[model samples]
Target: MDDLVLLRREFDAEEGTFLGGLRPDLVWDKAAFSRLEQAMRRVCAAFAGRDELPRWLVEGFWFCADWVPSWTGHADFPRPEPLEYYEGAVERLRDLQSWFVTGESPYLEHHEWPAI
Candidate 1:
C-alpha cells in the first residue's frame, strides 16, 4: 500500500471560517455545489475502497467543514445552517492534487489508474 499525502495543509480556521461566511444563506448554491460534487465523486471513485485515502480527504468530503452538527445531532457550528458540502469537496480535491501531482496535467494523469 502507498501512503496518500495531502497536497497542501488544511485551511487554517480563519480561512475555513471565511469560506463558510461566503455562503450565508441557508439555501445551497446548487449549481456550483453540483459541479464540485461531480468532480469529487470522480476523484473518490478513482480511489474507491482504497485504504490509502487520507483521513482529511475522506472526512472533509463526507462530513464537510459545516456538517458537524448533523453527525453529532446538535447545533455544533455557530452558523444558521451547514456550510456547503461541495465546497469542502473542492478543497479536498485541490489538496489531493498538490499532494500527488506536478505540472499542468490533470490529476488522473499522475497515476496509472484506469478511467472511472
Candidate 2:
C-alpha cells in the first residue's frame, strides 16, 4: 500500500480518539497524510485532468509529528482534558478541515505542520 494510504489508515478512527489506539499496527500520527490525500483528490476531481497546484503544497503532504501525550488531570484521572501537543493540533486541524470542506481556504499550502 502507498505511504499516504497507510498514514490515513492510521488515523481512520472516531472523530476524537487516539489514532494508534484503534489500529492493528499500533501506528499513529497520520492525520497530515490523510489531509493531503483528500485535498489532492479534491483538486483532481475539480480539474478532471492536470491540476498543477504547486510544488510546496504537494511536498507539504509528508509532514506531521508522532506525538506522545503526557498529561493527567488529577492523581487518579485516567486522562487530561487536552493531551500535550494535542490541543494546539486540534485547533489547527479544525481550521484546516474547515478550509478543505469549503475550498475557499486562506491556507497558502494544502498541507501544514506545526511550526518548530
Candidate 3:
C-alpha cells in the first residue's frame, strides 16, 4: 500500500501559540483547517495513499505563518476572557486531534496507547 503522506504534506497553519485555534484540524483534515485546504485537497486527492511523504507534509508542521497582527495598535496579548476561552477550546481541539493521530494505531501500536 502507498503512504497517504505522498499525497500532501500534513497541514500546518504556521499558527504559533498566537494563532493556535485557527488551524485546529491541520493534522486530520487540512481542508477543514483553512481556506487553502480546498485547493490542496483537490490537487492531492489524486495521489492520496501513494507515498511515504509529500513535499508539503514531509515536516510535521504544515504551516508556519499567516497574518500576524502587531500589538503596536492593539491592546496586547493575554487577551480578554472570552477570546481566551475560545482560543483555549480551539487549542484543546487541536491537541485532541494530535493525540488521536499520533498516539496509536492497530497496525502500529495498541498495547501502549494512553488512556485518552
Candidate 4:
C-alpha cells in the first residue's frame, strides 16, 4: 500500500494520535515518525495553495494533528515537529500539525483527553 494511504488509515484508525495510542512495544521509532511527518507535509503542501480546501482536508487531513501528550506517556518514541510553512491555508494546517506533533493546539488553551 502507498505510504500516504497507510498513514491516512493509521491517522483515522488512531483518531489523530498516530502511534501514540498503541502499546508501548508497538510504538514507532524516530525514522517512522519522520516519514509520517513528511507524508503529512506533502498533503498539506498539496492543498496549501488552493483558494478553497476540500471537506476531507478540513475534516480529516487537517484534524490528524490532534495529538495528546498523555497518549505517549508509555512510549519513548520521538515526536514529530511541526512543518515550517506558515503561508495562507497552510498556516492552519501547520498549526494543526503542530498540535498533533507537539501537543500544542493553537485553537485551544489546554490539552484534554478526548471524552470517550
Best by TM-score: 4
lDDT of 1 at 39: 51
TM values, all candidates? 0.37, 0.34, 0.25, 0.43
Residue pairs in steric clash, candidate 2? none
C-alpha displacement of 64 in model 2, angstroms? 14
Error of 1 at 114 (Å): 23
Report the lDDT tens digits of candidate 2 across residue range 1-116: 54344434434443333444423334333454345334434543353334354443333322222222222112343432336544555445445434434454445655554441
lDDT of 3 by residue, 1-116 (tens): 13243223334334432234433422222233343322333333343345443455423222321222232113433333355543433443344333333432223323332211
In the predicted model 1, the residue pairs found to clash are: 7-99
Clashing pairs in 3: 9-56, 9-57, 10-57, 12-62, 12-63, 14-63, 14-64
Ranked by lDDT, the better of candidates 2 and 4 is 4
The better-scoring model by TM-score among 1 and 4 is: 4
lDDT of each residue in 1-116, candidate 4, tens digit only: 46557566655655334454444454434444455555655555454445565454455544443333334423454434322321222344456465444443455454442211
**Better-scoring candidate (TM-score), 3 or 4:** 4
lDDT accuracy of residue 66 in candidate 1: 39
Model 1: lowest-lDDT 10 consecutive positions: 1-10
